[model samples]
Target: MRTTKTLAPLALAPILALALAACQDRTDDAEDPQSASTSEADAAEEDEEEPAPVSILRPDIEPPELPDLPEVPLEPLDLTIGFPEGGMELDEEAKATLEQVLESEQVATGAPIVLRSHTDSEGSDTGNMRASEKRGELVKAWLVENGIAADRIRVIPFGEQNPVAPNALPDGSPNEAGRARNRRVEVAVVPVPEETVPDDPADASAEDAD
Candidate 1:
C-alpha cells in the first residue's frame, strides 16, 4: 500500500465547473415560466396572422341631378272694378269680389285696405271730386255693413284723374272705352303678416352643435 498515486483531479476541476455553470443557467431559465411563455406567444402570433387588404378610393363619383321646381303666381294687391257715370253703388260683380277678399283671411289679419275712386271728367272739377269722394264713401259703407271696420278702409278720391285709357282719340273724338276705363275704383288689399313659428328645442340644440 506504499505505491504513489497520480493527481489528475486538478485538470478535470475546470471542465466540471464550466459544466455546472451551464446547467445552472438552464435551471434559472426553466424557473422563470413567464419568459418562456412570452417567447412562445410572440412566435405563435407571428406565425398565425397576416395583414388584411385595403381598398383604394377613386375620384370620379358624382351626385345625382335634381328635378325642376314648380312655378307659382305672384299675389295681386289691387282689384279694379268698373263703374257707371256718377254712380256711388258697387255692382254685383264688385260686391262679390269684395266678399271674396273679406273671407280670404286678408281682412282677418287686421290690416287696412284702400279705396281709390275715380271719375270720367264729365262734370265740374268740384262736382267730380265730390262724386269721387261719395263713391269711396259708398264703398266704405258697403264694406262696413259687411263686417269690415270703417277705420280699416281708407278713401282716396281721384276725381277725373289717373285714367287708365285716353278720354279722347287722336282726332279729338270721344272714346267710350277710355271713359269706361276711367270710371273705376281700385281696392288695394294689404297682405297678412306671416306668423313666426318657434323651432324645436332638440333641433335647435343640434343646429347649435353643428
Candidate 2:
C-alpha cells in the first residue's frame, strides 16, 4: 500500500504542472500592452478626423441704377412759295422765300429737295417734256449758285401729261389760262429727321432723374 501511494503522487505531478502553464499563458494574453495601445490610438485618430461646422453669414450688396433723360422741343415749318408770271422763273418774292427757307431753319443733312417743272398743252408732248426738263435744270443751277449744295436737289420734269389745269377750255379747246398756270416749276423741300438737334445732354439727364 505504501509503494502504490508514492507512485500515484508521482504520476499526478506532470498533469498539475501542465494545467498551471495553460492558465499563465491566458493571463499574459489578456494583459498585452501593445494590443491595448493600438486600440486606444485607433479610437483617438477617429475622434480627431471629424469635420468642422460651416458658417452662414453673408455681406450686403447694392444694384446699379439707370440714368435719366430729358425731353426736346419741336420746331415750326412753312410750306407755301411763289414764282414769277409767264415763265418758270424765280422772281424777287420767290428768291426771298427760298433764302428764308435755307436760313431760318437748319437745313438737315442728307435731305433732298425735289424741283418739278411743268408745261402747257399748247405744244407737242415731247417738246413740252424737254422744255420742262430744261426749266428744272435751270432751277437746280440757280439753287447751286445760291450756296445750296447741288446734291441736295433732285430735278424732275412733268410736261403736259401731268398738269394742274383743266383739259377743256371755255370753247372746248384747251384753256389758255389753265395751260399758263401749268407752265410753272414747283419746289418741294423734304426735311431730314436724323439731322435734327436734340436737347442738351446735361439737361436731358436732369429731366430724366426728375
Candidate 3:
C-alpha cells in the first residue's frame, strides 16, 4: 500500500510538471512584444492580401453627333479639239471627236457652247486671227448641221495670243510639237441658271393679277 501511494505521487509529479511548462510557454508568448507584433503583422498581411469585390456592370456611353456636309456643285463640260497643220477643215478624226461631243449630256441639254479657237505663232497676228475665226466657223457649222441651235453657239477667236505651249524652245528654235498643241479649239458647255419661281403659287398669281 505505501509503494502504491509513492508511485501515484510520482505520476502526479510528472503531470504537474507538464501543466507548469504549458503555462510558462503561454505566459512567455503573452509577455514578448516581438511575438505579439509578429502575430498582429501576419493578421494585417492576410487582410491586406484579400482581393476586393469586382462589379459586372458596364457604363453607358454615346457617340458624338456629326455635322452635315455642304453639297458640291457640278463642273461644266469642257474639252479641246485639235486641228491639222495650217488647215481649218475637219478630218475624220476631228469629225469623230465632234460626234462624241454631240453625244454628251451637255449638248443634248442645249447648254450654251462656247468655241474659243487658237493658232500657232508661225503666221502674222492678223492672218492667225483670220485662220482661228475660220476654224471656229467650220466647227459652228458642223454643230448647227447636227441639230444644234445657232443662237446657243458663241465663237471667240484667240489666235496665237493664248497658246497652251511655247512656240519656240529656250535656244530660239521653233518647237514644232509645242506649236502643234497650241493650234486647237477649247469648247465649253456652260450651265444655264434655273429660273427662280415664287415658292407660293397663289402669291405669284395674286402679284400677276395686281
Worst 10 residues of 2 by lDDT: 75-84
Q: List RMSD in Å for every model shown.
A: 18.7, 19.0, 11.5
* Residue-level lDDT for 1 in candidate 3: 91
Instruction: Rank by lDDT, highest first.
Output: 3, 1, 2
lDDT of 3 by residue, 13-43 (tens): 9899999999999999878999779899999
Query: Please, what are the lDDT tens digits per residue for candidate 2 over residues 1-210?
Result: 999999999999999999999999999988898998999999999989987776555445445587776544325444333332545566787677667667644454435778778877766889889988887887778778878899888878887777777756778886766766677777776555554454698887787799
Estimated TM-score per prediction? 0.54, 0.49, 0.60
lDDT string for model 1 (14-118, tens) is 999999999999999889999989999999998788666665645576556898885443254677767854467778887887777677655676777899998
Clashing pairs in 1: none
| Alpha-carbon local distance difference test for all models | 0.79, 0.72, 0.87
Report the number of the highest-TM-score candidate. 3
- For TM-score, candidate 1 versus 3, the one ahead is 3
